[model samples]
Target: MLPFERIITIDRESKVPIYRQIAIAFINAISQGIIKANTHLPSTRDLSKLLEVHRKTIVAAYDELEAQDWVVSVPRKYVAVSAKIPNLKPKKWMDEVNESAYRALFQLPFKQIVVPKVKSNAQLPEVIIDDGFPDVRLSPIDDLLKIYRSYTSKKHSIRNATFGSAQGSLKLREVLASYLSETRGLNIEKEHLLITHGAQMSIYLAAQLLLAKGDVVVVGKPNYSKATQVFEQTGATVVEVGVDKSGLLVEEIQAICQQKAIKAIYVIPHHHYPTTVTMSIERRIALLKLSQQYAFAIIEDDYDYDYHYASSPYLPLASSPHQGNIIYIGSFSKLLDPSIRIGFMVAPFNFIEQGVALRKLIDVGVDGYMQNALAELIRMGELKRHIKKAKKCYFSRRDYLDHLLQEHLKSQVSYSLPSGGMAIWIVLKKEGLVEYLVQHPQLAIRRSAIELNAFRFGFASMNETELEQAVLLLKKIIEGFELQGVKGQL
Candidate 1:
């Protein structure tokens, strides 16, 4: 046996528990090749005496190591490092040089992989106008935590944390079935739904199942860029369809269908991204007909159907009768917070079965503990109450922003008040606004579509004070441009 004193150190002053420290020391020793596989460890009593710690502490440390499969205990015998551990020691100088030389001898055929532009490192201003993210500060987190703690502390919840179905928690699916049916008029059953990490994952799963190499997928111009990237990542070619005030031009999509076999058409009809244009009912019927004629899948991303302000929002195309070839996805990330990462996809049973299989390969399952707690929240009617409360707050912010824009920016910018969703699409009439805003360290905005002149200003995430500050700064910038007689160029 190796000397226990040489292999392990007990740091009584550290914030980490004595047992955890002991287990960490053993792990480090094993990883660094100081102890070989199947090497016996000192007895719990001896190690305890050697480290001057309690015997129970040493026992706890060994339990941890065994539980993690780092060590194993023989029947009526002492514990030893697991023999299953494969040697992974750091390579010597010659071995590393030889490996590098071996790799250099091969000519790789892989294409250049460009990094996706999901986020930027540009310095944030004092006040940021986001693209319709929810104000998580207003969420019912206290109540959620209380119920979460209650569910997880139960003895049966051990299975929930350890293993779960790839289809996600059955309870959550059942609750969502009723919830979507009641709210959005979707008549879905638990068998037709698959839970995902977020709307992004839902999009990815659909792409993997429906798209193949060189398959054509149609997306709206100025679409959700993130979803576009996800579809393209699956080796499918993404074709852009121009979007107008009435949403995607279905006539243009029909024109494309005559040219090639299209696999899918991805669209966000309700309050379309960046522009916030709702698809006309006429266009919706026309697109549905085209999908049937071409036998292509329609990936409908109804991201923010919950937060409508002007009137009751239109029910999703998936909720319609005779709805086929439609894969509808929605997310609660905006309702609660993006970090929650709860999203669901509704489709035909066969598609759902395939999606669950693919999901198992990527992630074993969604968070069972979180899904169960959310279901409880839905059952207790807390989720509905929170949405009601949040709606009122968001409506007020939207109107306040509207009033501010009309008062301060009417001459320099033009916008249509969105009937729903959390942002107003502002079209800049002058060119210098983007450059001028750069000088002001207290104002931030998101550019819309492919044009730097069009921007989206979301009010839901900011308080009224921050909103006012941002607009006032923008007004000042525009006024300075007007005085110089500078016509804003695209």
Candidate 2:
């Protein structure tokens, strides 16, 4: 006989009734093959004695077993494990599937994206330097969330509960149309903007719609890496133009265009990524003229338009004439937080309509509730107030980081004080210095990045304390590294 007492340990503290516990135990026993088919169960009175429970409880357990078909009863004469129950075969719980299943057997239909190799650390570093991003600590998220909750509950807003148009929320677009006009000097209407998940999506849509196989798209040699990936996905030939202190060498782009008819150019006119070098007005005008001359589209990713400290930032290329050739991309995510995916593309009406149709193919729509909520935030002037506050905070952080770099790593590095943007483009004085710094245990630098003996120390994400901590760690690590032999440390 099975060790019935040992198999069915009772806990009085458990919320489950004593009788139900007995029933469940019997069922488990049968399933596990401990209680085989046609085995006679102990009598209720005997089980009651064994379990130290009342006979009524044992009787209830037997009744439950009988009702569930786990046991058969013979009119109070006998209660036995059901002969009708199938033979139980327990599985090998420790067994796993074959190892070959880890890798795909067949070819993927599309080009697989390359995943970057990350350094494996037992714990996350205390100091993380991001590639340029807005500080979330200062974002007006509480106010935005309150608006979101209100929109979700209010009956008047219920009609917009479902997925909105592919173009995006009408209210948000209208608000942006007015907002962009005022802030960035963009001459756009609701019809010209296509709200997307973020600036990357806008970049992708522009790249996909404007480019085709064998077409050429001119970009800087050290351009925004993600934008490069997007353009490459379209099977378009990417021509590399050189960027200088003035910005993209439009002369190089003209040289490329002379050889081949290009489709578009992805330019970051204000605070170019990694380097944070703003384009000169002369280059901006020259590029616009070249666009008219070559009939190529200009993807002006003016994401850091609002982050100026020196003077009022230059108006975007889209704000200039020849609007037909430029697709302007901007982001609210950069202004608030990276996680808040809200960005827009400004293009001609016909082009936007095509993008909308293409967008609908792969997407149902964006979050209508979030869009409306943001629109409310903008309409209330809360977003502008927040930007105004954040800009001042960021300006202070920028200067603080600048001072920290000058104080700590001035001997080992050289950099230009950026008039705007969240990061300073620090160029290392020694060879292999950037690569060695990347290996330091206490640091994780954002890598959109790390080319041309330079990297961006994204100051906006960290406060003065964090900036000080990061800079101090950086100084300590570099000092430990022997530079150019003679006991100079890596």
Candidate 3:
């Protein structure tokens, strides 16, 4: 056992709140590495007695530390060291003001910027089939709370609360290094992982890191809309490449790169967003080759690898040998709950340091306690078990939705049965189906789609019963469209 140093020193005369002083001291110790990772410290009672302070005071101090992600707490037992010292700083006032100005100007009511009205109801439906949100009903809340409680009872050192190193928690990186290597066959070290808020943030960071204004990036047509928006926000010219049953047409991507100076290609190969079509292994290899030949990067958005229902799920595009040009993005949002907000980017070892630096500038580090808890979850094999349970649940829902679609709206609408992922993209026989449905007397909510003819339905969020009702309602809407006899434009 490591020697327990006197971690708490209180000055009653100091003007600073006891809690704030305690938080500062804890951060200092963590920075010096005096308190190591996973090291369980004395209980709050023991620490209060040792420091001759009231237990309540220590509790308050510890609460501050926990909020900052410096320590982890367990009920009535002990607290544990969860993260290392973070190296972060507050943004300059000028930068903040400048950003605020830009947003204000951009958000000024403009014709091109279509802002949707907020929903009036405070309570959303329990089963939301239209929104592409992962089902969080089956998350391991008990285990998470247990872990959270375990880490919060100790006295945090000064080092632990300070800004962390940009790469994120070392323990998280270490665990993800092994997890990705084993599960996805991607060879990466702790140094190669840069943790972010989620895959969306990963996309934004990759754009910030790799792209400059006026750069060209090839994206799949009818791609993840948010990704396209991110690229556009970065002032990059987005060129859409058509996707077939196999995947993005590699030859078309090649032709685009040949014709223009392409910076990167953003794609979801394992299960494409909205439309869950796995890119073929041959196409994956071809994409890597194209990137190698064209001297561009491939941003592989491997969003839903955990719940694959196909006989053989498509391998990640980054799994193959390439010239260190693949920026592979993964997230825990789909596997676990979106509230977890932990995702990672796997890049070449050389890019790790710079990426971490950029990440620090972006969000400092992600919540340290969550990262530590996730590390513990991964270490104890709880994560895999949760994923297994989720896969079964989602697959059942997928089947239920498919059955409902076939039974009701068979010939009027067409959809590809997805092997995995949270949502299915559907194409209606008539254009403007979404408009027509929203305008229906019964339903008043409007939605946006990539095309007037296409819309996505997420099966994961709804249970069998809720799904049955939603499909029945949707079928009625489709039938109405058929009755109208809308023809394609000449």
Candidate 4:
């Protein structure tokens, strides 16, 4: 008989329950062939006595083993290893397993592994100056939950509750069609829309469907990092053009078009990411004409378009009368909360059909109940009301942050108050400040996607009180550098 005492060791301090620990030890022994299949396991009472554990713990562990088909219990006989398990070679214990051993034993099946574009901290700080995230406190979460409860309780929900249309809840698509057409002047219907997990997923679906090897996708120099990454993953070549205060330099794009057959051109047109520069109408019109002339798709990402302050928001280029070959992506995450992963894509019905098919490959659809809840909100005009209330609140917060920045770091940083969007692009006037902020133990901020002397100050997530706290902390960090500067420090 095996030395069962030596085989099973217990650490009472371990977080794993004793029963689970016992079951795991047996499983390891069985899989390693230290205990062969069809071998009788010690009776629960004997093992409990040997291990000095409660009889109940041993019974529970045996039950666990039986449930997993690792052992079978005979009628008034004994428990034995299941005959089903194939003969596996004896292997070293867990502590002895290393990378080399793992490679020798197992195969790494994935052809490609995804690498994240940004490095996220293990945990976020309590107070955050986020990268253009919406304030969750301002989202109409209670109302949304109330509506969600109503739909799930209704008996007909069973029928509508199953896998919804691949494009998402038809109710949501219908409501969004009306809401967008009314608000953004998008001439679209449910057939032209595909609801997705979020804008990133929408962008990814568009890229996978439209781009392939040897294809070329155009983007601005200082563009949204994730969008560029998605386009590149399709094995297509990504071509960067310059961006100015007016947004993507169309002339450079036109120059690129003359040289190569451009497959798609990505633009954040309204309050562009990282830079926060809105494209002029002239550029919008020129790009539309070029797309018609050159036969390339336009991926228009109009995130946070509803929160404009300085002027009336430009209706998306897709709203144009001649709009075609444009794939428009927008997010409800900004209106609701960042955690609420609801976004939509708008294109011609034919393009939308293919997008829905591709979306099914990744996921069946977005959460049906949540999608229906949102549809209810839009139908009752509650969503619009919430947006109106939150927009005003964020507008005030944006101004409050503007005032704080001007008061505190006026000398150290230079920024243009954006016409619209959640963040202000502030360029650090002096060198080494960005690196200093990065290395600071207390500060949590993202480096800009574009390698520039700038960073985005997302004020929308922070309130006046929180903004005051953040700016003061930043002021201290900057002033420490100022003192160092006075000493002609390295």
RMSD after Cα superposition, model 3: 15.9
Ranking by lDDT: 2, 4, 1, 3
- Tens-place lDDT per residue, model 2, 461-489, is 88888999999998888877753454544
Model 3 per-residue lDDT tens digits across residues 15-76: 98876776676665654565556678677787777767778987887788788888888877
Model 3 spans with C-alpha error above 4 angstroms: 1-127, 155-163, 438-452, 479-490
Against the reference, the lDDT scores of all candidates come to 0.84, 0.86, 0.75, 0.85
- Return the TM-score for candidate 3, rounded to 2 decimals: 0.72
List the lowest-lDDT window of 10 residues for candidate 2: 91-100
Greater lDDT among 1 and 3 belongs to: 1
Q: After superposition, how far is residue 207 of candidate 4 from its true place, in Å?
A: 0.8
TM-score of 2: 0.79
Sorted on TM-score, best first, the list reads 4, 2, 1, 3
Better of 2 and 4 by TM-score: 4
Off by over 4 Å in 1: 1-113, 116-124, 160-163, 435-441, 446-452, 479-490
lDDT of 4 by residue, 325-397 (tens): 8899999998888888999999999899999888888797568899999898889888888878877888898
Models, CA RMSD each: 7.5, 6.8, 15.9, 3.1
For lDDT, candidate 3 versus 4, the one ahead is 4
lDDT tens string, model 1, 1-490? Answer: 5666756777678898999988987787777666678888888998899999899999999999999999999856889999998776743322222122455645867765577343342676666767888999998777877878887789787576546688878888999999999999988899999989988889999999999999999999888878888888889999999988899999999999999999999999998997888998999999999998888999999999988887888889887765468999999888888788889999999999999999989897578888888888999999899989998899999999999999888888888888888888888887756555544566655545435567788888878997899888788767876776645443
Candidate 3 residue 127 Cα shift, in angstroms, is: 6.0
